[model samples]
Every structure is written in C-alpha cells, then in structure tokens.
Target chain A: MLDTIRRLVDEQGRLAVAAEAIGDNADLYATGLTSFAAVQLMLALEETFDVEFPDRMLNRRSFSSIASIAGCLHELKEAA
Target chain B: MCQACDSFLDRLFAKGVLHETGVDGLYGRGQAFEAVIEGMDRLITRLAEGDHAEVIRFPPGMNRALFEKSGYMKNFPQLAGTVHSFAGSEKDHLALLDNIHNGGDWTGGQGATDIVLTPAACYPLYPIVARRGQLAPEGGLFDIQSYCFRHEPSKDPARMQMFRMREFVRIGLPEQAASFRESWLERARGFAETLELPHHIDVANDPFFGRAGRMMASSQREQALKFELLVPIESTENPTACQSFNYHQDHFGELWGIKTASGETAHTACVGFGMERLALALFKHHGIDTNGWPTSVRAALSL
Candidate 1:
C-alpha cells in the first residue's frame, strides 16, 4: 500500500523530488506539494485506491505526511 | 511610453494615473486613473441597472464588533488593519510629542476603536440585511462599494494597501444565488472582452492562513465556491485577479442570522471588481494613451 501510495504521490503530487527520495514520515507540504496540486493527488488517490475521502478527512493533517496518509488509507480499508 | 516593463511605474507616473506619495502601497490616483475607473464604474452602473440592486455606500471603516462577528480575524487576521489613536492626558500627549520629535514610536500608546478598515465591500451588508429578519419572497440584491484596506505593502503597483471595490451582492435561495453568479460570470467575461484585456476565469480560493487554512482553501476550491478573473498585470506568468466571483453557501447567512423569505438561511454570492487593478492592466496593455486604445474598447468604455 505504501509503495502504491508513494507511486501516486510521485505521479500526481507534483513535488520537486521523487517520492522514493522522501522519507515515509517527511512532511509533504514542506516538500512543496501545493494546495492546488493536492486536489489532483487526491483525485488520483481516489481513483487508484477506490476510496472516497470523506470531507472530515480532507484536511492538512490527513495528508501531512506519507505515514499519515497510509494511516488514513488503512482506516478506510478497515472500514470498507 | 516606457518600452521596458520594469519602468511600468515610471510610465504611470508620467501619464498621471499613479502618483507616488512617498508611501510604498499608498498612492494618489490622478485624472487619467479616475477617468478610466469612473468610466468603468459608470459602464457597470448602466449594465447593472436591470438588477435594481439597492445601492449602499459604506464608510471605509466598519464597526469593530461587526468585524469580529464576521470572523475575518479567524481567517485573515494578518491582513486586517485596525484603526488606533492616542487618547490620553495632557502629560501623555506631551510624552507622545516628545517621542515623535525624538524619532521614537508613539504608535504604541494608541488603542483600538470601534472602527476597522473595511476588508471587503460585502461585509457590512450581510448583518445589516440580516437584522431586518426574513427576506422578501423575491430575495434581495445590494449594490455596495467601499475603499477597502489590507495591510499589504508591496512594490507591485497592482497590490495596494487601500483600494476601491465595486461589488454587486445577491442574497436568496441556492438556485437564485447560483444563477446570479452564473449570469454575472458570463457578464464578467463580456466586460473583459469589451475592455480588451486578455483575461481568464479560474477556480480559486482565498489565501487562507496556516495549515487549517490550507484545508479550507482546498475545500473551497473543491467545492468551486470561488472564482477569480485573472489578468496579466505585473507578469504574464502570474496574472492579477482583476475581478472575483464568490458564492458563500450560508457562511454569512448563518453568522449574521440572515434568512430568505422561505425562512431558511440565505445563500449569498457577490461579484467584485478591483477597480484600480483593471485600470493598471489597461495602462499596461494599451499604453498610457487612452485615445490610442482600440476604438472598440474606447467606444465600449465610452472614454
């Protein structure tokens, strides 16, 4: 899941550096994943993972870092 | 006309559209500037005559209590400018004078007032209309304008600390407000075409504050509540938003207790034009000479 998430972040995050180059706990915002690009990444995530991010989970903290996103996806997977 | 772009301010200075008053963001608008600005205003007035919006002109400063109630501070505390003054004893006045004479900071003794510089043209109207209870069955529309102040000091002529905002607001049901925005969106495009400025409308959000604000901005964009008509002013790569269309889905209605004729919270939308910024764009694009502008634009603006 992490690898797949990392791949999506790499493809859709529009970050300056590769996703694999960043640590799993590195802050995405700090790496220049802008608010504008976040939506694209989000849409790509929903498409790739087949999960809709609820409005409550659509916040900076939920996407703060790869670990946080993985945690959120794990919760969603469990809920499903 | 100045050939190089860096001398844009110099050109404005020569044309008397912008006058430097030794302040970074505060400057005087001369005849040329006012001519185009007021010309555009009159054009809008004629165009908006059909709407029959109640015209309300507010003082630049608003009541501090209302300002707080609007929660502008929560989202944009950094940009808000609060008026403060020195109210003190004779000795304190003497001390203030001494501090100023000695080049000290006398502003520290100043205190906040009931007034706050108007940040947006629509803030005061919501509560005022809300206090009147339920709206008419036909809903309400307002034509409001004010000199708004934001504490943004910059070298860019497009970004001013104080500027005028001409806005038309719609207060009513969801479908009505949405339609109002939709029509105005088209009208805005028409106005841009008439003015002969190269522009585009894009989904946008307010420059919210902090991480929470980041989320708010995203959600706002995701919901497509805000749109800005961006015109290339200072740079072609990054254009300035000369006009904005926003639909606040019951944010102000809930905060101000405004309701529609049906007794539900009113949905609100507004279209605002950054008067000076548009003029700046014209000057940048059409050169300082208004007469030299394309005849179609001149005829459209009736300049």
Candidate 2:
C-alpha cells in the first residue's frame, strides 16, 4: 500500500520532489503539492484502490502525506 | 429609492450617490460616487508606484475560448456569465420580433458569442503574458484594472453584479509569489488605516459552486492561498470584503505555459482592491460628504 501510494504520488501528485525521496510522514503540500494536484492524486487513488473518498474525507489532513493517504485508504477498504 | 429605507443602499440613492436601475444589484453611480472610485483608484496607484509594474487595462469581456480553458465554469458555473447575441436570418429575426410582440421568450434565438464577461482583472493578463514566452530573470509584475461581472444579484449595495477590481499581479518563483502576497497583505492594512476604514484581514475562500466546491474551498483555506481584508459596509457583523490577496501557486503558469527565466512553471499572486466596495466603505465609515470627513482621511485620499 505504501509503495502504491508513492507510485501514485509520482504519477499524479505533481510534487517538486521525487516520491522516493519523500518519507511516508513528509508534508506533501510543503513539498509542493498544490490543491489542484491533490485532487488529481485523490482521483488516482480512488481509481487504483477502487474506493471513493467521502466528501468528509476530502481535506488537507486526509491527503497531507503518503502515510495519511495509506491510512485513509485502509479505512475506506475496511468500511467497504 | 425608498422614502424611509434607512439601508445604505437607499441612503446612497437619496443622496444622489447612486441611481436605481430597477435591478437589485445594478445601479448607476452618480458623479460623487464616481469621484470616490477615482480617488480610490489613484490611491492604489500611488501605493504601487514603487513596484514599476506594467499597466494593462482590458475590457470587461474576454475571449470565450480562453475563458473555457480557464476552468472558471468548472469551479463557479453559477457565477459565470457568457455573452450572447442574436444570430439569425431575416425570417428568424421576424419570428423573434413576433415572439417579443407576443411577450414571449424572444431571447431563445440568442446564441453564445465569442466573449465571456471577465471574472477577474488578472484573468486576461495571464494568457497575454504566456504569449510573450519566458519572463525576465526578475519575473513579472503588472497593474491591471477592469470592470468584472459575476452573475450573483443581491440587494446588498456592496455586492454589485458588475464591479471594478484593481489588482497588482506578480508571477515568479514560489517564495517570490508568497512574499508578494505577504507584503501586499500588510500594505493593504496600511491602506485601510490611511483611508480611515476599520478593517481586519482573515482567511477566505472563493464561492466555488456545489458539493465538490466545498471541499475545494476548505483546501484552499487550509493552504492559505486566499485572504480578504474585510470592512463594515452593508453589515457590521459580517463585514464586506474590500480587498483580497491571493496566491495562485503555479496554477495559471502551468495552464498558460508561462515560465520563469529558469524555464520552470512560474507561481503567481495578486492583491485586488474591490474599488466600488472600498468607495462605499469610505462613505459609510466617514460620511457621504467628502468635505465633512476627517482631515487626515481626506488628505490620504487626496479628496
């Protein structure tokens, strides 16, 4: 799941730093992920994991870092 | 104009500051009102003089194709206004007149024109800058003012359907963009002080449309991308936004292919003065009569 999140970040995060260089707890926004890019990442995550992010989950905290994104995905899968 | 309507809107009309146009949010500004707008514009110019910003004045309408590419409709479809014109043959024209004569919907034949009302003063500038290729090593700064249109109509005098926005836009690296917004945020407060207007700066979000937009707005606020300097105009409890400071990151630069001297996508920021709203705030806080205003406030506006 961590590897997949990293891969998706590389693919859709549009971060200034390489996903490999970023720690799971790194701040994605501080590393240059804009709200626009975050939306792309959200869409990509939803498709890859077959999980729809609830409107309540659509916030900076839910997508702030690779670890947070993995945690969110885990919750969504469990709920599914 | 109401005979005893104590609302500021009615007061303005009674004082010959505004002329009612029958529409809720549309009104004609009398000479006194226009003079205040002019003074506010000059004050903004004086404040930005040291920046040596390139000045560009665009008409209220912008290219429809460019407007589509702007993603404005996607964000705020409710506020978007498109220009439409009657494009019909002689027979269609006759049918249109007949429909109008019958008091029917004659506007059905109107087609969307090649123009859309410009949503913001800086909307047209980005594409123009992109066309010029890479920016200078110092990046770019511009002074722009335009009458912008938003579809929301309200009885609030400050919330006009058509309004003037004066902006100073900066396009460059992230730090450059952020610092530009930071500086202007402070400068704007000073401006309010100079104008003797009670104001406060706070985090703000655009009125993006729909359920998805709520999330977008929260994210925007979280990122601290937008801020507004609010002043009491229509309601003291909920002050009207008189000035806005926004940092667009690399959104426009990426969309319009604008680049810095180093060939990276340039970030952008803008500080916008809601000219009409500020004028109204000045009148509300000080008084309708400019001569009766505080000597310092009048001196600051050079009124």
Candidate 2 lDDT over residue span A21-80, tens digit each: 999899998998877778778888988999988888888789999999999999999988
Residue pairs with backbone overlap in model 1: none
Candidate 1 structure lDDT:
0.88
DockQ of each: 0.12, 0.43
- Which portions of model 2 miss their true places by more than 4 Å? A1-33, A40-55, A73-80, B1-5
Top DockQ prediction, candidate number: 2
Each model's TM-score, in the order given? Answer: 0.81, 0.89
**Location of the lowest summed lDDT over 10 successive residues in candidate 2 chain B:** B1-10
Q: Per-residue lDDT for B1-303 in model 1, tens only?
A: 436754777777776778998877799999878888988999899879899999999999999999998989877888999999888889999999999999999998999988999999999899899888899988999999999998888888999999999999999999889999999999999899888899999999897775446677876887699999999998999999999999998778878988888789899999999998999999889988888989987877778
Candidate 2 lDDT, B1-303, residue by residue in tens: 444558888888888899999998788998888888888888888988899999999899999999999989878999889999999999999999999999999998999999999999999999999999999989999999999999889989999999999999999998989988999988898899998889999999999876557668889988788999999887889999999999998889999999999999999999999998999998899887777989998777767
